[model samples]
Target chain A: MTIRKIDIFRTGLRTFFIQSLWNYESLLAYGIAFSILPILIKLYSKRDIIRKGREYLSYFNSQPYLAAFILGMLIKLEEDAVENSINNNSKISSVKASYMGPLAAMGDSFFWWCLKPATLIITIFLVMYFNDFSNALFLLSFFLIFFNAFHLYYRFGSISFGYKYGEDGLKFFQKFNMNLFQKVMFQITFFLLGISITMLVLKFPFPKLVENIEIFKHIEFQIFYGISVIFLFFIYKLKRSPLLLILTTLIIIFIFSFLKEKNLVFLRIN
Target chain B: MIFKVLLAGLISGLFQLDQTGAFQFMLSRSIISSTILGWVLGSIIGQPELGLRYGFLFGIFFDLIWLFRLPIGASTPPDYQIGSSVAISSLILGISFFNPKFIYIYVFICLVMGFVSGYIGAWFDVIIRRLNINISRMSRYYWNKGKFLKFKSLMLLGLFNSFVKAFLITIVFLFLILILNPILNFIFENIPGFIVEGFAIVIFFIPALGLIVVINHIIKESTWKVLGLGIVTGAIIFSYLKDFHVFGFLIILFFCIIIWVNVLKKEKV
Candidate 1:
């Protein structure tokens, strides 16, 4: 019997609990095997089923969300293997394994690197600016449902493509441009980061900038602030980590703080 | 009390870090984890504000700090959810338990605990993932019989193991905090006030470091102008409109809207 809709749906849902069997040696191998248990059981009887399990329970990892696409594709491959009695076990595993790295790179960039922060920064902006704690729970829930559902929807769609065309379905990955979304979201996140940082600087005056309102209004101070932020851009350009910028800035601030505490404060711009 | 905290710990850990993540539904985020914790504590204390306010602050900072922790491939980032939950709930509960009259030092301790627990939590995750691998060999039995139900049963055994892992982490974290809290309180009471102020300063400064890290991510030649423009808007708001917080957020909001529309509009073109 061919795979039915109920089976596809069950496997998709089981994808969530996949990491329950996670281990370092094969990473998510056992989890992958577990997710496709029904398909394996139906396709292979007795020892053959055990062989399929053993085949899957070896070294697998990916961005978990994108793994759904891989899972969908693997189910189709497995079904094809049984239907044709093809000795394609190695091909199936390799196909799943190969897709993991690239999909992970894409998912990590799009979901982890981009969307995660974008939603977070948006939430921070809303909560802090309004200072309204109301619906903080609702907002969190809304975010959880929206982003998770977006990827899940994509995963369900991905499975169909994977089944119909096998490896060719990967070409569809190109049609989905995550870079543009990432760019826009990154822009907004940076803009808000600027605001949030400025708010902190103002809320907790950097000892030296505390003295005069006029000091900040000065073009020199504006330029100084601009340059400092641009310096952050440079730090990123050098392919240096963000942690370095934070440490350096913190050291700079601490030194200024120490100097001020010792009455070694410098002359004012005025 | 222990049971209550244990239950919260399980929910936080499982919800945030579930590996299979059905339909991509698990958030596994510090913000949501801590918020859920805070809301739980708030409901217990009959003070929604307590849960929400603390959750928001702790969540924001944790979100900022963990920005770098994108768990790609087999590599795992520090498990901020379990750590933050342990840290947040301990402090929130402390307020009620000790009936502390002041807030600042308590908040400072929570910040420090956040880092401490985050480190521990990350290590715990590594350990659990390592241990869970053992289940793979055992899954062979179910596989032999083509027993899909048995396979799911084994996976549940593994999922329960996850909760067990979380339980261990939370217990250790809470135990240390409890043993140290009294001595620390005494020392804190005796210490010079500036030291306390310094802690507060450091805690407040954390957001900036976190924010800077995020800004660092989007840096590119093309984005520099956008970056510059954002800084200008921010500085102007800082310099002139510090008091106009909402109006300023609106200004930023207005900019975001225009930028979003322009980008989407351009893509369509």
Candidate 2:
């Protein structure tokens, strides 16, 4: 017998909860393990088991954490449907497992390690710049939860799509590559980093300017624009190392300090 | 369990030290174990800050050891909890012994202790793997015999391994701290300011390494080039709005969103 839609959803949720027990390392390992169930079933189970197992495995593969929490749930689901040996299949299960591993790695690297930290760092810097640690922490927590929630939603949606479309759905995603989403995310990250760095540089003391204008008056926005252009040039044309860039910035800061000390240049702000 | 924790801590610390190449000689000269060994003694004797400072400094030397990925020879020490506990306990004992000078002697001792702990943890891992294999076989046997207890056993075994590792490592370090407190305090007092500052810089850079890893992953040629542009643009906007209070960032964020949604959004499409 074929696996029902509801059964697949229930199993996916169950797998998610179970997989959550494992720590980061264990979760990755287990996700791979469970994803291969279809292959295992194909090899050992009879024809009917192969079919049903393939259907179930496809749904499991699409779930978040690559259905890390769903391994046990998938196993349990298989056990429940054991009587319907007609629908259980193995080949499909293996295929799902094989695909999900790479997908999980991509998700884990992009979302967990890179984007999340970048967002949090930018937010934290802004908060600190504003002298609002409380709100910063709040925003930090919010983003963390928000990201995780999105992960869950995507996992669930993917799995549901799998149940409805099977291998076809997986193929579609592979073909499309979520390019649009990625571009948007990259843009967001770029904007945040750009603004935060600009603020940081402007806040650096401009002794000469302070003397003439009421230091805070007339908003010398041009300096920020100029510095940003310089930063862009360094990042683009020089392809300089972050360490080098940081060192250069520090050296510039020191030079500025030395100049101020020597009275080489002064800005008199009204 | 406590012994295991102490052992893991020692192992992690030793691994950290071993990674330091020649720096191990310096740590060897200065008594280091007292700070970490203090944890096992159930008293906060060693300076937690100092252990981290030294641990970080010690970490720089051990960079070569990180290639193996085994905690045995890595520059990054195991968790800080292990060293901190040991250090604290040692300081307490040093004060009690009336020979605070003895505290410095513990550094070398702690390094040795860490090495032994690494070996112990490695041995335990091997044993756990063997047990897992045996259990899997046993489960298969039971399944062949129409018995289902193997599944339950597997779950229990997995839980046991994770707990054991975490628990044993914590315990071993705590024990080391208890025994070595006296010598640690004596050494802690004599460490030079410059050495401390050097170590501090090392600690500060560790997170930067983590950042590099993240950066490398993000800056692939195809996807992340625009990230540079966004940063440059945002910086320019920020420089202009510096005096406007927090509202500056908010306004910047708003403009960014618009640029993202409209300009970049169209290009991507």
Candidate 3:
């Protein structure tokens, strides 16, 4: 029996909960079953549904957004199982096991590492440039829409494509070349970040003495700020905790401010 | 005041549902959620501008600070939502309740508290995940007994648990803020002006650290040359162009170049 449009829609909607029941033992196994239940219910009787659901109870995990594609392919496989009695559980298990790691890597790199940061850098740029509340709000709305639009398109498209093309739907991932996309995103983000850093440094309230020094006047502050960022980046590369860095900075600032208050020699900035 | 606290709790609960329960539409993100919370608080107090300022300040800090912490797979990073929500709520509520003159002190204290609360929230998140082991087991039990409805209900139960966790954390923090307001007010009165100024300075510098983190993430071996070009471009824009109109056009031009490059790449492919 062909899965109806409404059932497909229902399955797509249920994919949202794929992480709702995430746990240690099964790690989205139940969620996978839960997401595909709409299709399973439409295709099987009560006994068959339980058996099919039981098949998914073993450990399974992947990037949450890409899980829909796997679910759709799984439904197609299940349909084939019902019609043609293809080799049952092992095939599904292997397909899932093989796909989850690569898809997780792709989703994490593309969505989490690349896109989120790019949008954020852009948001910071716009907000800093505009420096207005309403504009900030409008920019924030842009962030949400820009992000979710791409998210929803892939989310729904993956489901439909996987269902339609079965395993061959993976060509979508191959065709996109996520690594190139990531490299491109890095370029854009780095450019924006450069601007943002400069803006942030220019806006910083330097001490009058520091600001007045002829040699330190024009862009010395920006240079110092850039060097500090590189220093901090190295500390981060050393796997030092951000909390530790913040605490150290705070302590140093607190000491300097205190000494300056005490009329320390040549250190007054406020 | 009680109504505001309750409303904040409700908002926190609903916004956090987007964390894992539903769409993952990034409503749970600190910047957006804090802004929305700030807007709501502003509306409640009849000073929308002040609220937005508070929200924007705290939101940017949290967003930038936690930008590098990716929640990939099973790795549960610090739950920044609680930290940001708690910080913003405390700041707004402290201002409303105590009417402290040294607002920076309040903001500073609230930020530290919020940062601590984030680690606490993540600890609780681990607990909740562990407890969900029992939940999945119960689900299996029901599935074995042919109780599909009950099995589905477990997922809703999981969602509800998440909502309740966020709500309870916010409510508890609100109460803590209420109890500590007098102490904080007293300290605010007694604190040295320089110390407060130092905190304000530190607060301003925190974002620089966050920027460092983002820069570290993006500036791989392949991208540094592009980043160098960007810095040069930014320096030119900041120094040469005083008019926003020119700046706006340049910004648009940059986006056009990005799009053009993408199109060129696609066509070549």
The candidate that wins on DockQ is: 3
Candidate 3 lands at a TM-score of 0.90
Q: Give the DockQ (2 decimals) of all models.
A: 0.39, 0.13, 0.50
Please write out the lDDT profile of model 3 over residues B1-269, one tens digit for every residue: 88888888899889888988777998888888987898888788787777776676677778877777776656777777877888888777767765434665677677788788778777777877888899999998888777888999999888888888888888889889998878877777687777765554454455677777677655678667667766676667666663564565476467637744974686589
After superposing all C-alphas onto the true structure, candidate 1 shows an RMSD in angstroms of 5.2
CAPRI grade, predicted model 3? medium
Second chain only: TM-score per model? 0.82, 0.46, 0.89
Ranking by lDDT: 3, 1, 2
User: For model 2 chain B, where is the 10-residue window of minimal lDDT?
Assistant: B21-30
- In the range B1-269, model 2's lDDT, one tens digit per residue, is 34434444454344333212111111211112322233233223334443333342222212211112322211223332233333333333323444433332343344334434444544555455455455544433443443334433454454455345534564555555655554555555575533322221122222222233234434556435555665565565555665666576576567657755775557757
Clashes of 3: 0
Which ten residues in a row are the worst by lDDT in model 2 chain A? A204-213
Error in Å for residue A126 of model 3: 1.4
TM agreement with the true structure for every prediction: 0.82, 0.51, 0.90
Candidate 2's C-alpha runs over 4 A off are A1-10, A17-64, A67-137, A171-177, A190-270, B1-134, B142-146, B149-153, B171-184, B193-209, B220-245, B262-269
- B1-269, model 1: which lDDT tens digit per residue? 67666666666656544533233354656677777788787787687677766776677767776677765556676666765677677776666544243345666566667666677766766776777666666666666666767767777777776666666676666666677777767866875543443333343444555666566665677666766677688778778986786787688889988877877887788
lDDT per residue, candidate 2, A175-208, as tens digits? 4345555556655655554444444344422222
Candidate achieving higher DockQ, 1 or 3: 3
Interface RMSD of 3: 3.9
- Candidate 1's TM-score reads 0.82
